[model samples]
Target chain A: MSQLKRVQQWATFARVWHIYDAAWQNPFQSAELLKKYLMGMHKPIYHPMNDCGDHVIVINTADVALPGDEWKKRVYFHHTGYPGGASWTLAWELHKKNPTMVMKKAVYNSMDRSLQRRYTMERLHLYPDANVPLNLLENVSNQIKQLRPKPKRLDEYKEEEVREFPKLIDLPKSYIVE
Target chain B: MVFTSVVNYVRARGPDEIWRKRRIFKLAAHFIGRRRNCYSIALRNVHRALAYATKGRKLKRADMANLWETRVRAGCEQHNISYETFREGLARTDILLNRKTLADLACWEPYSFKALTDIAKRRALDDGLAGIKADTSIDRIITRGTLHRDK
Candidate 1:
């Protein structure tokens, strides 16, 4: 056998995807999902030193919800150099002030702190509502799965689907409408 | 309530006189030049600045994109993979990583980048015969999520 080692060719690249904000799910979890994209951890080409993450465009920031009392209890603090400059802004209060900042911060802080964090942040585009410009929306190629299932509206069920459901028992003629 | 033409009191927007008259000047405030203060010059200056802003944005995007492509290309070179081969392999494998993110990974995460190169190399070899068709854009190129045999 020859002493020389095999030298194969070809390089790998990262994949990016988009995420949308829905009121029903956890933004924190979604932030990690964003991080996964940014780090390119989801792909076989992912390396710890590589920034193979994808762009995440989030919309509907106005409707993002926090569990239980995070809205009231959570506080973002800021201090100016002047006396009594220290002040606190609650989560909901901050959200009211700038709807996009809440999810943006969550996604930002979720990643491992490094110089590239800001670069990853640049790829994250947040919008307050569903009214995204056509140009921006057109670039989105994929989506991350949501933690919570979207609840279906009553009227969303098709007539055929309702009819197809097997009935366990038939109501007697004396059945009264509740 | 009766209106008169003489000595009309304009409801000043704020306490500062300069600020009150800053309707057109506010547009020039962002510009760093003597023209920002000079009213006649500021008028034309603001118009020019607004026009340039649109063009500047497009140029800036192109500039950054070029830099990112350069970075990704350099990263591929380091791993002994040609940029063309790497890009083609990735596209065939359905990996849609944009240049910015790829360059980022190239700079910050060398090991991850190496792993990516390794995969691309393997996939490139399997490129011709194994035409594994997956429709979704988010389909995992590496993971053999589905099993099918040639009939």
Candidate 2:
């Protein structure tokens, strides 16, 4: 069998390095946000020169539910270097057509565009289907799960508990309707 | 430091003594979970540490695609067609352009995007003959059975 077929057909991908647990729920940081999340500056092992990270494989991109209007508002753009060479697309369309590529591209772009970035990217494998070949993940089944915390109800916090933001003072007279 | 202490404790007790007791790790985790200040933070940190150690790679493609679609929708709106209508028109017209490629063209080549949109618009305008609504969303089309059934 072909290597691609073998990899695809395996019930699990063993020693697959790392796979994102479906249970993990958190908004991903932008380029700047990643620094804090990884504790880049604070870690003892911090080195400006090295990619001190492990391999990660993401599965189930189609079902990666987001919290709010992020899915509706976020815009992705690519330039092909021509007059009017700016193509943009919404996220929902890409997810429907190609789930794996959507995620792989995001992670790749989020990382520093360097040789180390390419190296880390090599470790990432994206599969759109929920039933990822079991062999790749066979040894790590105990560690993988989908355990998102139930979203806390805002009503439970009540009106007083919510922090009030500073009032806006520069309201445009034309924009104000009666 | 904690790892060394745990290792020393196991060594002092003998390997078999530690191996026989499976709940030791769980007990340690539970103890850590109960601490009011530093220990509770340490427990959560340790849990995340373990997760990062074991969790799989995630590229966050869904987020990326959403970002792309938003860009596309904004561009489509500039052309006076809502993204919902544009997508519906494309589906009805049987246009093979995927959003990624469409977004790519829309960003790089406005003329080409305009041409493609023209095709969709023409198809949408011809909806009476095609028997599909030109100005609707994919959900409505699917739900209303306007999508071509393979009967």
Best by TM-score: 1
Among these predicted structures, which one has the highest lDDT?
A: 1
lDDT of 2 by residue, A31-95 (tens): 22222222222211224353444344466665556558766776678799999999887777766
Over the stretch B57-134, how does candidate 1's per-residue lDDT look in tens digits? 999899778667767766776566667778777776688898888888887787787777666665654454232332
Model 2 alpha-carbon miss at residue A102, Å: 4.1
Error of model 1, residue A11, in angstroms:
8.8
lDDT string for model 2 (B1-151, tens) is 2465676766675556445343344434444433323444545665665676454234346545654575566456446565766777778767777777777776666667766665565556545434334543322223122334323
Error of 1 at A50 (Å): 2.2
Among incorrect, acceptable, medium and high, the docking class of model 2 is incorrect
Give chain A TM for each model in order.
0.74, 0.54
| Tens digits of per-residue lDDT for model 1, A92-139 | 989999998888888888977888888878888888888888887887
DockQ, Cα level, model 2: 0.01
